[model samples]
Target: MTIIRTIPENEAVGEVAEIYADDVESLGYVPTHTKAMAMNPAAYGAFQALIRSVAKPLGLRRYELVTLAAARGTRSQHCRLAHGAKSLKLFDEEQLERIARDYTGAGLTDAEVEMMRFAEQVGRDAATMTEADSQRLRDAGFTDQEIVDIAIAASARVYYGSALQALAVDVDTPPTLGEPLRAALVDGL
Candidate 1:
């Protein structure tokens, strides 16, 4: 049972309306993930803010890279499917499949794999992190600030993914995008 009602795209108002409009224009639909957050405008807005705050500092690829790993680590198909769709824009089918099955086996560059490993750890147990963790990222060429940003991005995904899952928000529908990855999104769903 859904613990919170999702706001229909057309019925959304104010911030939700604006956000929904952007989603529809860019992705073709209001993602179920977004709709779930729309149940509480404040929470939805906060999610948006958190994302924007990291946009420049983390950049899209790195941020999504960490996020996808964390999503998989958390066993959240909702997040995995969504972030997996976004990742398809940058990576090939085989690479994405590897990431889906196991990032370490994906043949990603050492730096990329290291980032995913860090994100997975953050998702699994942040308490386990130590100087060695920072050293690993440093060895991989990530600066202290970048490491913090990666951690923040990975940690933030838990909020929406868990909430949507707990609220039983749907993820069966694929996001709207065109070209090479459109089918990939469907496959992810």
Candidate 2:
């Protein structure tokens, strides 16, 4: 059970309901994470806005890759499960398995692998990131804007993963995800 009471979509009023409705319409279901976030409407709105503003401009695939790396580095079951599900659409079963096992060997382009590595580094040790890290990303073809957006994406997962863990929010195991990705996230949990 969740530590924080999740507000039902029907019980939410005004903007909350509106946001929930749109989410449900887009996703075909209201995610438990969103409901948990609804406890603080302002925070939820800001978070949702940040996700859209940062992620939409970048390709969803790239953003999802960063999210996956951060989720793995942080060991957040919720993000690992959720983003893994989304990743299946972009990667094949064998590729997803490789990513879950070891992203470095997942057959990604040099730029993508470098980005994931950078995201993991930020997630694990943000303070330790040096000028060389930034230079590496720039050399790997990430522009200044993209680097900033990558940081935002990684930072967003820190809050999101921690909140979901604290709330004990259940990770949804959608049928589309199959077994490998699910196993990757919920294996020890």
Candidate 3:
């Protein structure tokens, strides 16, 4: 359980109420992370906007891949489970399990593998990154814009994921994710 107190769904009002409503409508239940972030609605909105901006250009498939890699690197099981479940839209259970186990050996293309590698680096330590990282993506045929989007996507995850970890928020497992894949994501390869 998290140490911070957050607005309860029943007592929510204004933007927080709307955010909770949207989550209930979409996810059938309010996510714990939502409650934690909703402690400040403005910051939560800004975070959502940033996530939307990152996801738009990369599209959902690539976006989820980068998110998963970053979440893994951050050691954020909450994000790993969330993004891993979202990844099911792009890959079957078996394939997703393979990815969660070892994305490099998950039959991804060179470009995709490189993209994930870069995201992992971003989540792990962006300060340590050098031009060689971007150059690798360039060699993998990613445009400068795509590269920028990838970096932001991963960095954004680092921000949110790290915050969630700091707060010690409980992980919310998606009901759709099977046990094997969930274990792979939560327990690592």
- List residue ranges in candidate 1 displaced over 4 A: 175-189
Top candidate, metric TM-score:
3
Compute the lDDT for candidate 3. Answer: 0.91
**Lowest-scoring 10 consecutive residues by lDDT in candidate 3?**
180-189
Q: Per-residue lDDT of 1-189 in model 2, one digit per residue for the tens? A: 687776777788987797789777766777888788777889988997898888987689899999988887778877887788778778887788778777778899999899888888777778999989878889999999998898899889888888888888887765567786678655522
Order of quality (TM-score): 3, 2, 1
lDDT of 1 by residue, 1-189 (tens): 466667777688887898888878877777877777776778778877887787578878788888887776566777877777677678776677766666777778899899988888787778888999878999999988988888888888876677777888766446433433444333432
**Candidate 2 lDDT score relative to the true structure:** 0.81
The runs of at least 3 residues in candidate 2 whose Cα sits more than 4 Å from the true structure, single-residue gaps closed, are: 186-189
Clashes of each: 0, 0, 0
lDDT accuracy of residue 144 in candidate 2: 94
- For candidate 3, lDDT tens digit of each residue in 62-106? 999999999878989989988887788899989888888889999
Q: In lDDT terms, which candidate is top?
A: 3
Error of 2 at 39 (Å): 1.3
Candidate achieving higher lDDT, 2 or 3: 3
Against the reference, the lDDT scores of all candidates come to 0.75, 0.81, 0.91
User: Mind sharing the TM-score for model 3?
Assistant: 0.96
lDDT of 3 at 177: 84
Rate residue 78 of model 1 by lDDT: 79
